[model samples]
Target: MPAIIYVPFGVYIVTDTVEIPVSSRVIGQAWPQIMATGSKFVDPLKPRVAVRVGLPGQVGVVKIQNMIITVKGATAGAIMMEWNIHESGQGSAGLWDTHFRVGGAAGTDLTVKDCPKLSGKVNPNCVAASLMLHLTPDSSSYFKNV
Candidate 1:
């Protein structure tokens, strides 16, 4: 049997697509968001918040930055990752509206492809992920804004 992890609480994030570096290039991708999450352990662990399902299309990455969140206590403690200190976005359709999770914490990781589609249609291409992660020491991680 597997360890039954539960995300009894969650925040909401929404975003749109725009241009990058004065050029018109849309960001559309299919990747499982690996948010820098912390778990209860002497040595830090990336306890996968195995979201048996995934986020919805209506939910964008922008909203994730300002989501009101609450964390359920893990073995360590109540850990929450802020979206204000990192860069993140939806792999597709962002209105130059990318953002970083001020704080990053452990949660779910999955794409529309990994879960059931709430849009009544199931197209792999239409699937994308919105992840919140920690920015590197260098600021070169973010996408150049136009």
Candidate 2:
């Protein structure tokens, strides 16, 4: 038989770090601010989000958090957002994760077990995803290296 990858939950993450110039730090924070809105998060039990503030004058924690967004079936998708706040004197970096797991046929969902692949490089900032859906050749795909 073929190598069947049966997963209870499927997750695809696109992590990228970002840097906001002191002149326009607000732009970098737009993503999280938008998610904070009530209409953004679909199911609280699924794609969870957590942020780490790194100020220009402050410190940044290299921590990973999943707010958890609810995935319906084998083809569910969710967007988890995080923020790293920094002081005006400097910029900050954060690891953003985007996971989606929705499988078909019998058994559990198609999760990225065994090969918990790491897509795209730790982005410079979340603004990259803010503009486009799939990455281009020059653009960063969620499954490429940094």
Candidate 3:
């Protein structure tokens, strides 16, 4: 049976990837954040996903909406989200009003004081992620107002 997961408005720190299974509907109130942190997501060459939607070759309904995804501390290799679910129908799988925020904000340790753009040099510590989102070849999704 399909399940509805409701996340309240708050900050959630995740040291590892959060996987969303098939036939699941995730709704967040007031734009809850799923923040990634830790050494596991620091290698740019071997990037890892912070949020994974469904397993490989999974065909079903997976909906995620009203959420904010971000990275904290040193996460240069973090891919904010990976979509791998093949939709069961035209509008079965999708994300709405969901957004991604990397760094340069509060609680991210990447403030403007730490990573100034006019500094004439890039600060490695301000590197938030390698990629924002990854849509696998086999995945099909309908995203609106993301």
The number of the candidate with the highest TM-score is: 3
Ranking by TM-score: 3, 2, 1
Residue 102 shift from truth in candidate 2, angstroms: 7.3
- TM-scores of all models? 0.20, 0.21, 0.96
**Candidate 2 TM-score, C-alpha based:** 0.21
List, residue by residue over 1-146, the lDDT tens digit for candidate 2.
Answer: 11211223333222222222222222112112112212222333353232112332433323222222222222112332333333222222322342322222122222344113375553221111121122212211122111
Whole-structure CA lDDT of model 3:
0.92
lDDT of 3 by residue, 2-110 (tens): 8999999999999999999999999999999999999989999999999999988989999999999999977999999999999999999999999999887799988
- Give Cα-based local distance difference scores for all models: 0.25, 0.25, 0.92
Residue pairs in candidate 3 whose N, alpha carbon or C atoms collide under 3 angstroms: none
Residue by residue across 1-146, what tens digits does model 1's lDDT show?
A: 11222222234221111112211232322211222223331112432221111122122222111113222222122122211212234332222323332222344323333344577775433222222222224212233231
lDDT of 2: 0.25
Quote the lDDT for 90 in model 2: 24
For all predictions, the C-alpha RMSD in Å is: 18.1, 16.8, 1.0
